[model samples]
Target: MNRIQRVQKELERANADYLITGTTSNMYYLIGFSEEQMERPLLLFITRDDYFLLVPKLYEEQLKQFPLIVYRDGEDPYSKLNLKENSNVLIDDTTFSLFTIEILNRFKPGRIGRASRILGKLRQVKDDEELEKMEKGVKKAEQLILEFVSNIKENMTECQIERKLKSFLIEEAGNISFDPIVTSGPNSSMPHLRCSDKKVKRGEAIVIDYGIKHDGYSTDTTRVFSLGKPNDPLILEIVEIVKTANEEAEKHVREGMRAKEIDYFAREVITNKGYGDYFIHRTGHGIGIDVHEDPYISPDNDDVIEQNMVFTIEPGIYLPGKFGIRIEDEVVVKKGYGKTLNMLQKELYII
Candidate 1:
């Protein structure tokens, strides 16, 4: 009843006969319902004719808002499925584990295939309501980060700073989109390093990567800060290179560009500076209800750009045993432009 029309459209495009899923995000997008994940599987069945939700008796009260087919424990939930031989079934590979797969095998659908790509592509393009919420939530999120950066000082341990940062986000927003990344000195060289007890030294690169969950959307961005100008010129060099790569990619992205083109564009900038090997990870990823989704802007992807698709353009350079730098911004694809949602300075801040 919610975005069923979109699913219907997808059915037509995908040429599928039926759809089934148990993922929470897919449930939210397709039906405006988010089920609590449990050991007992919560199943959603969508056909050309109707929608059905099958869950254990315990969830019957919680699902009263929608039409559901409830079953008791130890009962054969498969008894309720309506399927025939040769019927194509689309399943969320991530959600439907082997346990769930075995249950579906009873239906004997002629074919079973991954349906995440179909849903992921559908989720890439945002409607006005989603865009409004994202913009407002991200603007407010930036202020909280500014507060963190302004108060940060030398000799603070990375874990302590992470705790304070998480505390601020938990106070302002109920959740984090992902675990925050806080690293300094040698640890900073690892792009995905989490917080540690290591003290943040002055005159070294410090990377802060984090995200916030607000208004049903997630905001992701990274900012690099320094207590004082590092004696190592390579750190500044890499930071400047990454900033330029971020800005260049954002400036040149458009509706017709291939997802890989953006990645290539950013990669070229880093490669020219001779730090290409040190720069790892994709240029960006589709972001919305889920922190990472479709339209991956990577060197290997072939997905084309379209207006209203929101994602990120993050570029970084990591020098092992030295330091690292990254500049990230959430961007929306427009007809002839890419609109970045974040307003934070990409330049390394000398805090």
Candidate 2:
């Protein structure tokens, strides 16, 4: 079913009169347009009987082409609605600003239902169109990674590498989903370390974790490489262990399986290698409009995996004061199995 049909069904089931918001993801999910709403709020007033999209007066001509959208000037959008009392309003917490929330509250005397988790649940399971967009995003990200590795040089500063990667992504007309992480030597141990001025030296491990956004969809990936020959046997050993863990997690991922089981699958491999403590974070998280979404893959989560859900299978072993190795790839859960979206090799590379 199409996204509009799915959302309509959910709205009927919840007995909501209308869904209001200015969130770009939800707007794109419902409508096809994902362009930035300049200065003006893009409120989607969805009801069982009608779908109205209110935008700034400046964008009236552009939005008017959309057959279903009922354009309204941003200065006074509510004037077009003429909302009735006792009507149920569904608001997305992520995109609803304080001023908008106050305006919505005035319409409904009682407390309104924040459709934060509900929208997340809907977005977690990708439809055919969303999956296709994400696949394109994955390919773009892979191409950018190849470009980055091919131009890598010895004795280059970590910041320089990050700048090169960012340049490549921008050149492809894609926005950075998040800040690129370029850590070398002992800095690799920090999972979320930002790029630094320190230059990468010979025989030092360089970790790069980054993502790109395409058509409102995101693709996340991580890879580690050394400037010269693998000097530390332990680094090689840990990289192999992480690769095994990541593959094992991907192998067991499928529909109807508990999210925690996937985490355990990877954790078992790391623990068996006597580096469980080094694997600090969760195995992965759901990837879609946001890099991190619902039904997180971790020991604490009990949500069952469903078909069309895409998430990362990243396993890492960080040895503080020494180095770290991490292998990550995005995957989508299939009916009876899972398919890895990233095609890059998992083996440690010597640049």
Residue 60 of model 2, lDDT score: 69
> Candidate 1 residues 1-351, lDDT tens each?
457767767776777777778846788778777755666768777776677888889889988877888889998777865567577778865574753566556767777787775788778899999989888878877988987787677778999899989988878888778888999988988988888899888888889989898877888989888888876887777888999999889998999889999999899999999989988899999999888888899999999899999999998888888888888899987767999999998888888
Best by lDDT: 1
Could you give candidate 2's per-residue lDDT for residues 144-211 as a string of tens digits? 78777867787778999899888888778458888889998999999998888888888888899999
Question: Which residue pairs clash within candidate 1?
Answer: none
Off by over 4 Å in 1: 96-99
Per-candidate RMSD, Å: 1.9, 2.8
Candidate 1 CA-lDDT value: 0.83
Error of 1 at 123 (Å): 0.9
Give the CA lDDT, 0 to 100, for residue 3 in model 2.
64
Alpha-carbon shift of residue 277 in model 1 (angstroms)? 1.1
